[model samples]
Target chain A: MENFHIDGSTYIPRIDFNAETGVLEIEGESYHEYTTEFFGPIFSWLEDYLEESGKEITMNFKMSYFNTSSSRRFLEILTLLEEYQNNKEGQVVVNWYYEENDVDMLESGEEYADDVELTFNLLPY
Target chain B: MGYMEHFSVKTFKQQLAMKKISLAFQGIFSQDVLALIGKSLRNTPESRVIAKRLFAIVIEMAQNIHHYSAEKQYSEKDGRDIGVGIVAIAEDDHHYIITSGNCIVKTEVPPLIERANYINGLSPEKLKEFYREQRKAPQREGKPGANLGFIDMVRKSGNPIEINIKEYDETRSFFILSVRVNKELQN
Candidate 1:
């Protein structure tokens, strides 16, 4: 019903969840002190959005890096998206963007894709 | 000087000389200081890609202390707790050695050592598989992570993770872990 946008910080990523567009984007590095505290609402927002809206969802991740805690959180987000994709009529697509030269980041995207059921578009820019 | 102190100092100096210490810090580990260190690393030699790798390892190591260190002191500004630890980065021509140490309960040492060894033993493909499995695994209660941080460290280092433990007292020990990232990765 509502949009969510939080600017990136030294330790956290930028999050933009647009209700109107049904497009959610998270970019930049995330190594926040309170990982769950920061991501709890974002998870809930996605849950509510999936239940409330009849629109397709597109999730984009463009992270240069993220710490271990944030890594788990991203996995959780992907798992949720996979769940929605499986049961819901509205489609869910994920795009993971990494630097072309970053082998680790590219592998990270592949790893995330491997865990979830949804087909992830691994984009290098 | 006591045997332990003398040995530690000597070994530390040897490491410094061998690796050409780029940055070193001891005592409190705080987010602000970590940010400053991360900022300074951006201008380092070779490539930004390798810089990011080194930075990721440093952050994981520092944050491990912040979350798990047995010794902690509260901050003045927000009264938020901060951990006591040591972290250093040293680079030779071929690799960057990032080391971090913190106090931990003596009982925790065995499993920590075992975990590090287990990760070191995994091949690259196995390590990636292990990492994926751990990501989906439920979080361990009380621990900040599901032991995923160590796996990530091993995966990024592209080398065997090294760990050393020194008994501090009857109840505590210092756990030191190091990860080596290839400088050639910069190319």
Candidate 2:
């Protein structure tokens, strides 16, 4: 299947998903005017990939900043990943990267981990 | 407090100097202006920890204005609709106070205050729990956000937010919100 890649905008994040490698990376800030519209295709692609490929997936969030609107969508993504990990034989691992000095970002990663079943490797850079 | 008709640059400068304000703006809130504000904050050689918190507060406050401010301005060049609001950042001995004020419909006041008060009443641990619940909640119609901006602001401030609402007209009122981030936490 095809991979997904979207360039970052002034108010949106960059997303790159590699189907072959089963690695999905989302980075930069996201505060788009149309939050759902921006994330809809990515969600669809991930679901399709998971159902069709049945391969192990690695989801990395290296976001510098994301607004509340984007954060809600992120929870949805996490929930889907949790489901993928539960039902499929393939494994799903999540990596959340935050700036070393940013406690809020670090805490945000921890918070997400608390809600999701999958463990998150909160790496500081 | 009653509405004041006297608002001038001189008075504004006085407030800035007296209050130790770092940044202040009163006009149309657009994406471009927000970018400039963010750039100005980044240009400062402050600790990254506090700077990130400050920047996040700015984004949430400014986005609130850009989307929900009652007063609107149409930009001819970009064909963008902008909001009118005021935002100010002040640094004191212990905390950085970020404040944003915008006009809101009178009917919106009750729910706004209710939410703010609810968030303010929550403890740190409870706040995190509340935020998780809110994050997973479905988005409200017409509001792209999950209505979690206020909660996020309260959570990041690490203190209760202060709010004031003054009736401006029969239909609109001025809503001001201030969040304080303790400098000691940066240490």
In the predicted model 2, the residue pairs found to clash are none
Q: Candidate 2's residue-wise lDDT over A1-125, tens digit each?
A: 99999998666789999999989999998877557888999998988887953568899999888888788988899888888888876688899999887888898899899999986899998
Tell me the tens digit of each residue's lDDT in model 1 across A52-97: 5346889999998888889899999988777777777667889999
TM-score of each: 0.91, 0.90
- Please write out the lDDT profile of model 1 over residues B45-159, one tens digit for every residue: 8788788888888888888888889999897753688888989998766888999989999888898888888988999889988888877789888766546778887777788
Task: Give the Cα-based TM-score of candidate 2 against the true structure.
Answer: 0.90
In order, the Cα lDDT scores of the candidates are 0.84, 0.84
Name the fnat for model 2: 0.68
How high is the DockQ of candidate 2? 0.63
